[model samples]
Target: MKITSLCILAIGLAGSARLLPSQPQDEQAKSSATVEGVFVDQDGAPLEGVHVLNRIWPGAESSTESDGDGHFEILLEWDGNKDGTWYEGYARKEGRAMLKFRADLRAGQEFDFGRLTLTPGGVLSGEVLDASGAPLSGAMLLVVDAAQQASAPEGAQADGPPWEQVIDRGSTDASGAYEIIGVPPGTWFIVAKHESTWWLWSEPIRLEAGKRATASPFHLESLPAEYQIQGRVVDPGDKPVANAQVATSVLSPDGRFMMQTTARTDESGQFVLFFSRLPSGTVDLRVQPEGDELDDGSLLDVSPGARDLVVHLGGTKVLRLHVVDDTGRPVERYGWGLSIDKPGSFVMTGSAPAFHEGGYATLRVPEHPFELEIRSDAHDRKEIGAFTPDALPKVLEITLTSSQAISGYVTFQGRPVPDVFVELVQRTPNYLDGVVEGHWNGLYYGLESSTTHTDQSGRFRIPNDFPHITYYARAWADGYAEGTSGPVKVGATGVHVELGVGGEIAGVVSVPRGLPPGGIELEFYREEIKASSINTSVGKILRTITDDDGSYSQPHLDPGTWLVRVHPSGTLLSDLGWSEAKVEAESHPYVVTVQDQDTTYFDIALGRDEPCILEGRISVGDKIREGYSELLLEGPFALDLDFSGVDEHGRFRLVARSSGKYRLVINAGPGHHQYKTITDLVELVPGTNAWERDLPVDQWTGEGIRLDAH
Candidate 1:
């Protein structure tokens, strides 16, 4: 049996956009690309009712539930390739205590992930007590990893992180007892904190899969007075706005330091909110004055001054949003966003978004004019509303087109070059890539990217939601040089790229006996410019890793004198029994040629057999750097498997079979940070290495294990 369902939301930067009139639904059902996968429980039995969600950039989401047999298939947004899309998402059960199983999707291809297993988690119950042994009521209980909660503020180095994960949490009742189900099986410590008492932790408890563990009582002490935010909400005329919804929020660009709490004002329009401690940065106090029957209220942005705040609110305008196709028919599912001076979501605590399903919504938006961005999986995006405050409309209707696509081909000397990976990028300001780049923190910028593999005919199509903007298409294939189509502007029927057969290189890598294949990295570099007859290193151009048989190959090279370097190269030594290691051992740079239509062969025997030890003493803390966890040597080579622990005197050692210049990353408390890294590269020869100075924990910042196997 087969089943399918879709949910999509379209949101991007606040800008201007337009929609084409609606067409018949059947006319919009052209692309037939599909992807499928399966889900099972820890017992290997098919798990049903799993929600599989898929999303593309510019806010397009599609979702479906698993059938009885655990199989699910979803229709992809097919433009044939005119606009290739980067797809990502995960599959999760509704209420099971299982961790979310992420789906590994190729940039633009469709495939199955065989069988994904979801493990049902265990449960945890606990009690809270005061220093005097009396039960404490209304204490918030949190379950987290024990490392960060250890008796001392010492640090440890872990392959991944010191995991301050909030696995599960619950609040204590009249008896000070709390039970939280769905706590994933793991070693956890319980933390109890009440408004009137200090935060305290219980001893670490390692839980069994699908079982239960009761935590010991936590004895907390009396807490001092916390920072209280004083505020009031009033109408423009100075009249008190009674029972106004108020909230104090602190958001930091870095994930550190965040808190949010909601409350309502009394008859005097006065409200008080408290935080465990005074936050360091900016704090936003939002107030929504209660509106009468016809209005739904709006939020007032305020900043606290001297712990006291006053805000004036005149309510807001009602915006009725309707999204339709070319034929004026409602789109099935869509998401919209609003932004004015900056990008932000208008979502608040109590509003329900059920109305988003029918391409319709009634929103109580800020009175200030703002841009409304809407989208659906099949439709093109455009900013629809950016009205002047006085001209803001009560009802806004938008029309969109779903038949948008961009098609093209890659050819080598007039012959089609199949199997090429085509990449499309738009450079216009406020475009798809522009919007995603700002919010994603430099993860993907300026390049709103779409990717797809060329078909047998060398033809490709990418669904173009922003066809009105200019784009550039680049392609690279096995037998042809990389090609680019510059300035594929709006209304361009196709993007044509011409490739040439440049130089090609192939080689086999020989490593130590037990070294598995595919972890080695190779970087290609070219001289800054051919100013002189000889080539001199400037910047890197390309990089590739070895295949299963320790072989690597690449074609489509630009004709130039190339120098291949193994600077900072390593291989991942993965599990023979669930452990992994990153072995850094590579050869020096080898000069190669990229002459037209030529092929070069080079063989490499990596790292010497002799062992090299780089040992050092290290400690961590905000103040006294004592206690040792584990630290990371990111460059050259890493020995995550061996003992790199520090002793009571803060001494440690790291031994690797191979050696090179390495970087030191002080990994502690959840994870390491930019500040924890040592900029100076420590070169290790065939013997012992040292820092010569006392190693310090400059900065410490702070996913996954699958236990489905029975």
Candidate 2:
């Protein structure tokens, strides 16, 4: 992932390579039988009543019923689905009865059949405590599975192991004690969150079948200490003053300051303020009195306590301005604005020119360095660098110039484009890679605006009034293609140009044609230039699910080399929380090229993965705890799969791409503490899921505080 210091920073993840090894043909020749058993949760010690089926049986279909012993009988049937010559593998039948299933099942007739014994699933329990050690009511705990990491949402993404599962949910109890039951037996990751900002994440834990896990006490810290500022407001003669409003603010290291408290001075000329929370760094103090003008200022180190200080008043600084035309001749009465640069921040002052017979007016500050910016209606602007203290007291000077404009017409597919927002994107070098950055509202050194919504005839004008020494522009319209132009020098007038829209691409996405038709999702990617080369993913072109018709499209594209791919929305499902039916593209690779005048059409096929089903439970001491719990997983030693689970009888099953080593973690819902590192590395082979784990039992058992199940 790459990180940069922008207004809003974002990063992308690197793709993982496919690594499950292939099975031998000789292994497929052996006769196999089905081994069936009962799923008894350790906490409840009861049988799971729901029928678990392997539909499209590449694997044999089996049924089980619990006897008086709490163990069930396994009955088997022969292969229900056959693989044709062109097919590579079969679907593994597994999923909740109501939700969707996307995995294929492998043939089960090759393995040896025997009396399969199923053990009770595991449990995770713990207490949520505040800074004072008292239970904190209303906290939340979350669990994430480790194997399906690629597809989970934002907060849950970091909790899962490298690539197993990703899910988030949890809530706390009235006493802050939480028990996450019904977790699968495996490695899981857990987290506890309070008040949205304060949180705690546990190291990965593993729970084996029939065992319960207890977590070390998890405590939420108190809010950070606050600081108090008090000062007096007085005139230049040092006399006591009354009713002067004073304000406090702290600068953030990344270039911003949040206002704290604003209060007025009392009859004693003194004002007292208590900041809610002091920011963790250097701070600046600002004081402004209401009514008749009196200037006062002070700077101090503000820590976590009441601070007393004194501020003195003085004459304000006078500012002078002049508006000039492109010819350098003075112009009268123009719209204008002013701004200032303070440490870690900036503020826009009064708009409209400060006018007087002498072209001057007075302003005041705490006697420090500041940058002054002045702008006018004619599109001209001027900036004066750092102004420290002037030895001789005087007024500041500002001069601006008039600007020129560019006019032109635009059309898409030979028709005038109207009611569309036309953006004038200027190309600028990105320090990290050299390629032009993405378009944004126009600014001089940054993106600056020109004009928008051309008139009925598709003719418009862009006034060259911003600070850029030079500019290049691009025009864009939603649902229609965008066009770009070569660089145009700033300050030049009467430049003319025309824009044209390109053709579109569309096609159907489906699974390999020979198999029984099933649902799948498809996504599109558009290759773009970045850095000095084109080796990275610049942006996503089009993202749409295949309809029952399996059709998709690249609504717009610049004629160029194109690469298309289809995959089960495994990645997108985990990333964006998208539902299955909406994504129709295949989960395989495809390619196509679009020419300037060609409306390209094509088709793509996809491949699917086998499924593995897991079952487990959560417990505290000797009792069953009810509530939501999540499952988190990690690989051989790496964080990967991150998934979640909710408990009634404490059981859960999840899907995966391919299997390898995995870890498991479990957590309780909101206002609760969580248990972690309860399970260790377990192997997941295709067509088999005899996997079992127990979350360590948390011992909260005592005389009248027992947890009761309804």
Candidate 3:
């Protein structure tokens, strides 16, 4: 077989060589390279009419068609630089799956690919019919990857992955027969949709290479007549209010919230909302005029085909705001903005130009009860609730009192660090209260108040507009550890930041034999010191992906205890026969400490031990909530696992490497307010393991609690 394959490849190369055009010696020496290949099917038969493409350099692509003997040759042009050592080649035919291969070639090198076999693609065929048993032409058929469906919430229609993930797509013919070609072998779900009908999904189907899978005929149920809600916006005086915006939220059939079609009122204040498909429950409709709010929104029952709506907008009131600094002068050089607490709220912002006319800014708003917030960089943020425009004073006075400047110098190991980014950040008071339960000690700060870059002298200045607030002056450079100053009052002067010479962590991510290169990710987390007054922002954590050679570096790490972890990408893990885990073991986080300007080296090997799956449920006071959980593994090794779409019954699953202890941190959602940190070590053997627990909502604190393994 090997001799025959080599002979066939040699024949293909010789035949392809004859088809190449003779080029000038000078041109060939400067830019020409040859890529010759033979296209064959799984049965080793020559496949003709195969399209071949060579993408070796930017803006230069060579393309050709396979001859009758499946021999193809293309001459590629090498750009000015010849540093690139690899080029990608692709081949595909009408009925066969596409094949991608990479070849290493030097400049002017002639590359010859041996017999490249194109796997026969799977075929999906089915018929589409309406409720009346008549063929439904033009019905769209989509093949979605089953893996995407596995993560989607139950009852939610999975929009087949991104355009690239679509295995195949087609439309039914006049006879309602649909056939999709060139689908890669895998498990997939078929979805059919037609105009005027509801979407229908098929059960999962496993397709084999070069095989055909027939799906049960889809009988799409006709959707009810689309409902239209027509309305007109008028002022209290019965005059039309033109250019008003209307919006409404509707639940999709998949049990997810989606926005309804929005429409703006025309010149005559006329608007219409069309609903092609309405959810089973009530829909909430909100209307906002050009500058007014609709206090009484409509709870629409869209089941009744069409209806008319009328919204009465209250009269408008002009509120004049006067802003001035403590010196009684117009606060001209500060950023100011205002926001309303209503749906489709509008924000009016600008510089001193907004208050140009004698330091007074005018605003036109509805004469209704609403919440308003006015904020300024040089003043405290003010929130007014239930304020009626008509009841406001003729001129509202806003005092800008907090104007200060903080200047600092950043240095690393007694040497000035120039071009470092300096920022003033304030901690949001009570940010962790109520939102996070338990002993949540992680400090969360608000957005940056002021930002600046250090000059050549390593000097930075942050002009603070809110003097009443205290902030931390943080400094970070490309090759230095993040440094921060002690709490400095906004009005404080001469704040200095001493940055530590950062360290580097170099490591090799060794993958098991038979695994392709790349896809391994490394994450480094700086340990939080309980006694330290300075809190590192989450953004400071370092993450990197392994190179093709399985090496990675976490550079410029702070001089402190840090956690290092290595894990395969989600797709790779799933492909390795590992099931998702619900909780991560917390016992073996790789801990390392670094000194100033030092480099640490560590190596990790994967695939030696078998992997296991952990499944469990998260419940609050006996009731399971449908949410996601983040499992943090710590032991002899560390990894992070994220699981989503816990059913309404509160079940979840995660995958982990076996023979390791893990710490599982489960958060109901992204919000840090509610979470459970499990410190008790969960040991996983080489196989499937399960755990179940009911976390009392009120009893579980955000602190890491040790739970004895049951």
Candidate 4:
């Protein structure tokens, strides 16, 4: 299973590999770990129906229901990087303090927390209103602790203190009123938000033990009309092609995925696509064959415009394939399917064709540069190389080899380790090996099929059902570091992995004692050049938050320089009760070096001296309509700048600290889709100063995030 591994920063199980192993050994074949616990309220009564979850990273995550007696029994099958790792245990129930305890969990073991008690929490009530003085329903609200790291929203009063961890969250009702229970008693702030348009926080709200507090009503500005792409999809003959799929990807200037919104054409072959905010990347559209009528089509690169647009699709062609084993016998389908992949295409391409036991496929495909893949279980997975539309024969005959099994052992410090997850991954792009899965994302045959687990003796078997491709054998287990072997071909014998003791980064986060707060989140990205683009592709090595004591630590980080910032969770990213990321006191990319088997100590402070302001207005084409912003202003890791706030007029103000002389990556969706680094757009001088410039939006061009190389 060559996954192209495009998001390699997912490093290990972060998001790279599947959560479960294909084959399990001994105890793993059973349950990897069991955590049992009983929950009670401060009054000693059973707190039934608490949500208990086993939080595992790069591993399987499972949750359990609490019995009427408040007892929860969570079972887990872990493929984690570290052994006997300490993971965050979460339990939540309305009107109760959310429990975030660190628990020691070892695979193949059962631990019971005899009696767990939860604290009774207070409640906070508030109302949200739009600029018209009318109630705004469906608005989300959260109360954040005063000490956690949190970046303020644009236009938020600068006089208020910073914040961290959400004590509680709730949504507004039809009356635009909200009441959030289970709030930990302390000093906090009320944050009212509605997607990207309206997000801002209150001054502060103080609550006492088991009490109720009312916050000041929140008033937000009116939002503008959303961006829309109105167009018609047509066939090569100039006839309307209805029911086609039109999609576009939103990516950061550095090629980071931002979001995606799609629309489907109606009966007239006309489509209207709307985005809450205009996207900053080229839009792509495709038309799949409609019952025996039209075939698939493509609209490669298109910069959406404000008016009428037409999409001419390349119609489909007929293709017949007869697949057989190397011995001239017809291949049997073990349920694996077949598909045509345009390796470099951005939008989802090709029709999903399947094969029965006879191994024959007759499918219509868009006339694009694509490779054929026969991913059947009973045969050695076949990759039929790339073929141009005119170069393909009317009927193609391909021979596959009998499927072969892959066996391997996992060892750490020369000792066999059981229950480790082992999977095969692509090491490089090979046209003859498989289609290019994704250019910027990397290329791979598939994910999860070529995966298995080690048994007590540390042996794993990838069931004999993978294509003959080069792959890196990666092994991981809880309580130890993840390990990967150099590239090896399929059907190789005695594949082995030797795990290592990875390094750690530990530190304390501080703030001006009398000032705002400590901070809410901490996210750091490891630097590694993507094999496909020779450009930086990112992933988080470790995820952690500053504890109440102001200390934080990240384990199992691959040795390298990492850029640390106060980003959110799941992006495993974080908050000060923060929805936005905060640039820390240090310089951007706050570089820290971590080495194998060593612990790097690095402390950080919150709130620096007054920041430097870099102000600019973007004059890109009128692609972005009024009352909306489709532009993003950002550098590597913006310190104090609120990059999310590029107003409808394309005007932006960046409050930065020590950014040096650097040009920010203006992720303008139009004008250019490819990137060539820009420099010195603004020279940020020392404390409390401001600089302004009007951007020549048309002059900016970039390499699109998609991988163009093989």
Candidate 5:
């Protein structure tokens, strides 16, 4: 009867299944399944040598290739159990979007998809030329889709997509012609980047299936000549400071310091600083020599031409500090920082002191009134302030108290949840609060100290060496909702936390006709209140992709009001591109109220595309800057959409996509002074959107933006 059941299971699995001969009944039972399929192109022609991947079945050869006749087979081995098992298959060729399929399988099941179709790929070709109309050789060309563009990291090469996101890439030949073959059918952005010139991009281009798209010739703009700052570094005795570090800073038009290039002095104590994108006008330049007592920084004018200069570090003040524990023993491995006392000055200079002997370290700074702070890994931080170096002791003594340990256990539904990760976050003053004073202080709390995991018994212990700080504990585990503990002082006794059973939200994302050709992602956001105020912060964003059938489920979501929406892959309009207003009108989000240990089902039907409008004002300081702001909208895949300038009323309007996050960069130049501000993660809704915001003056200080500077 068992042998008959195995044969029946194999035959019932699928019509295309192939059952192998039965194994010896005396031996341990061995069961296997076979899946057979054929690959063909859209026009019904067999696709030879296509690669088919089997991702659904584990413990098997992952891939196989179609034969000349486009026929392929996959063998899957299964354990004795046959309940609730499934398999997935994917087929692909170079330069094509993968074709996906899925099916259910049992221990002795054999399934055949019969024949699968593959979509054809496209091609992009173009030529690159210099500004003078001469063919530019050795230039790189990149093709990218919308998803790759939107998720690219900041400061990534603007000339082309990042290496990992490049769908197709090619280098210009002697004739400046480049061809990228096997580009999948989609809307793509093409860019040409030269080694010595600025990048040139094409407007969005659509490539149709099995067709070649010829793009317009790209003209590369010449880059400005390299600005050089050549100078020599010397000590107070006018002796060459060989191998000394030379640093420079450029001042912005708003009178803020911006750190620039750095170079180490050669044997001759001479260094040359090069700037590929040097700003114009006078720049504040500072030079510091390695292990020297001198401060040599000044203002210098920069231009396209190279110039010679010299810097001399005069006498500087050296302050020594000694760190020790409560036992009066020298403590090694400590960090210290210094802050100067001046209006609009929020620079905090830090150093990793090498406690070679007696826990003593030295620091060189300008002669001024300064506040000092010191901290260690295993101790509480210490701070001392308002002391002038002229009246200081030779070695300042600083003490640190030993850290404490906190132990705890995690439970869900009265049962221990092992392998739970607990995070200890320190709570500090909300710097954004209006009541907070000081430029850089009082905005946020210090960094989190340590993380520990619970054992099989749900027990966890923070190391005894953790710093003493007021913190709260948050615990989370796979397939479970997160839980938070109240603020606990590290010096207190053991803590306990209880997590609620996680719930699941399952749904299907479908387009008007059917599922999108490619994969789609669903974004889940939970609204949380900031501090103890009513201001809301978008918290705990969870993202998951849909399967081939456009079905998705996210389990272990904490009990709360969650806003769930579909984000279509690529530059599709109905997905992330919808505006908030349009989404509300169209009921785009599937708002679900989750309960502990329960499941909720919701289905979403994407809406039609609608025109989007964005209008906003640019304010500089307290006054609106009319007709001065230049805004650039950067969309998914780094598509640069240049818009018109601001009107005389300091207001600007733009037509954009319905949904998706954008980066807005406002550049304005009052006289020869240029100021720029960037606001990232700007969400756009359908219909009309209005914004009135201030454009803070861009700061260029080497330390960071001055907290007091506007």
Candidate 6:
């Protein structure tokens, strides 16, 4: 059976099913079942010389690897079992480019269904050159395609499709020429980056089948700069500290500091940084070493009201602290942070110190007084006495009592949602990621190690074992409403809570009569709240599906905005006549807003068109391959192609449309694989009923993988 969205959201054990509903015993004696054909590209042309695997039956694999005509097939046993055992179909990773077909059979039954198509992805090749017409060596390039425009249903996401990828990387040869191939046919932007700072970009390029488009010579010019800054680092004994890291983050006019670059201190503890290139402005230089701790201090302003200037750092001292229980045993592990406030001053800076062997680390102010605040995971923060740098680095060890715990269970419509996501947050005046004030920090106590599933009965528990912190719990499930609990204060033990059952979205896909000829696929995606590159379950997709519209219905979708798109089978689009009409409702793409207890309905209609044919041919080393071509049009733009062809005697003609700047993509069989495209736009007038182009299939000399595993 094919993987489903429900399986993805059902947690672990329940996802192991490899087959759908089975067939009856009498059907098990069938002599054979028909297999589907595979094509290359979005176009329905034959794909020759490829592997195929059967998931349900062990040792049942087939290899036809197409002939020069891109056509082949295999036989399989599909008779039903007495106990109604079902037959499952699937292709192994190596055969992913090919499609699998299932069979309904009985004893002595014979299946003869034929014709399956597979489309191989297209490729793009080009060179990066310098001002003097020489290839640029070691130039880092980034390619971004224009295909990031689709909106998927909630929880399902596509990793920037084939048309988009970081497709190539290599240094130029001494001859000053470079070639980056193996890119999917589409519109792409090429950016040549120099080091991490200096760089340049080329205008967007488009690629077509069997052609090479040359780009005008590109150049990289350095940005102008002005002014400079310097600084130094030292240890508590006033000795120069080498190898310390120092950085400068200039603030924007909007008061936000951009990310800074790090530089190391020299053997003399001194450092110099050129601030040219950067617009004239006030910049903050922060210095620190990986292993060294600093005593409480303030930024020393060198020039008041000046946008640019120099500054120096004095030596720093370290302080050590230990927090434990009344029994005098050291505190094992917990979150710890500190705050420094000088005498007669309202200013204070909070910091989280690194924990070592017997205690925690902090900065000690020599001959000065400062206060300290200590906090732990799930525990309330505590303030300690002020001390000067003259004081000993080690402070007295002590203990703090534990806090209360809170727990909860969440369900939807009387059923426990196993994969429900939960979070505990505290809204307070706090510092996070070195920033003084921001909305709820993306931190959840015990989240990483905690079990995030509800039992069969829909029961869940969150143990809050800490020392005086307060929190609120929030839970969410896809396709259902989300719920949150009131704030709970934990003084000594945990508190219990339960959430109400939420609403669900259920509806069958009712298609219009005379449905178009094509297999359809669906995908989903959720909305994001905040910007973050780090990995966390929060804001990430919970599930997705490549198929829908059967008796089964997916559940547990949280209330929010959802989008759904219909991707018709590449086969029908390539072989049959289908009007290229965008999917929309009321003249605009459908927009759905889901809420608690809300249920919605949606039905789709497919468009049709008059039949047309296009022709093309290719060649590679005394071999010729011929096949059909397909073109997908969008508004005034027609992009993307899928065609399978073969090469024998060095020539071959495929058929399709004869108009628009189509993303012409073609592939050859096992003999000699030759694939290439033209990024430069091309125009083909309609009513001609024909188009012809010649291509070359390069022979394999035992080279590495030409295309990445999609």
The best candidate in terms of lDDT: 3
lDDT of 4 by residue, 442-555 (tens): 222224455656777998656554456667777776566668774677577688898777878889876644332223356655432222332212222334677766688888
RMSD of each: 15.8, 24.7, 16.5, 18.1, 20.5, 24.1
lDDT scores of the candidates, listed in order: 0.53, 0.44, 0.59, 0.55, 0.58, 0.40
Instruction: Report the Cα lDDT for candidate 6.
Output: 0.40
TM-score of 5: 0.38
Across 1-710, the per-residue lDDT of candidate 3 in tens digits comes to 00000000000111100011111111222356677877888787899988765676543456788999888888776643232345777665656766778865544555566567888776778899998999997677767898877742233232323446555566788888877666788888887876546667888888887787889888877765455567777777777777766666555555544545566789888877655455455554555554333222233344434455677655556666677767797753233333333334432322221223445655554444555555554354555555666588877787655445777788877778788878787643422234333423223343434666787798876666676877788887766678878698766766788887588888777755566646466767643222122443333555687888888887777765567666465234434544332113322245566666888887766655445666877666643444555455443223343344566676777656445665555545323344444433566666777878766657555443456533
Pairwise TM-score winner, candidates 3 and 5 = 3
Q: Would you estimate the TM-scores of all the predictions?
A: 0.38, 0.37, 0.45, 0.41, 0.38, 0.35
lDDT of 5 by residue, 358-446 (tens): 66766665555778887664456678877875787777888877556666789987788897877665544422233223312111122
Candidate 6 per-residue lDDT, tens place, 171-219, comes to: 3334433343333456655555332224554556775543343344445
In candidate 1, stretches whose alpha carbon ends up further than 4 angstroms from where it belongs are 1-125, 128-190, 194-198, 201-215, 218-247, 250-274, 278-283, 287-367, 370-500, 514-548, 561-582, 587-593, 608-710
Consecutive 10-residue window with the lowest summed lDDT within model 1: 701-710
Model 2: per-residue Cα lDDT over 292-316, one tens digit each: 2454444556444545567665433
RMSD of 2: 24.7
- Candidate ranking under lDDT, highest first, comes to 3, 5, 4, 1, 2, 6
The 10 consecutive residues of candidate 2 with the worst lDDT sum are 1-10
Which segments of candidate 6 are over 4 A away from where they belong?
1-245, 251-272, 275-282, 288-322, 325-333, 340-372, 385-396, 401-710
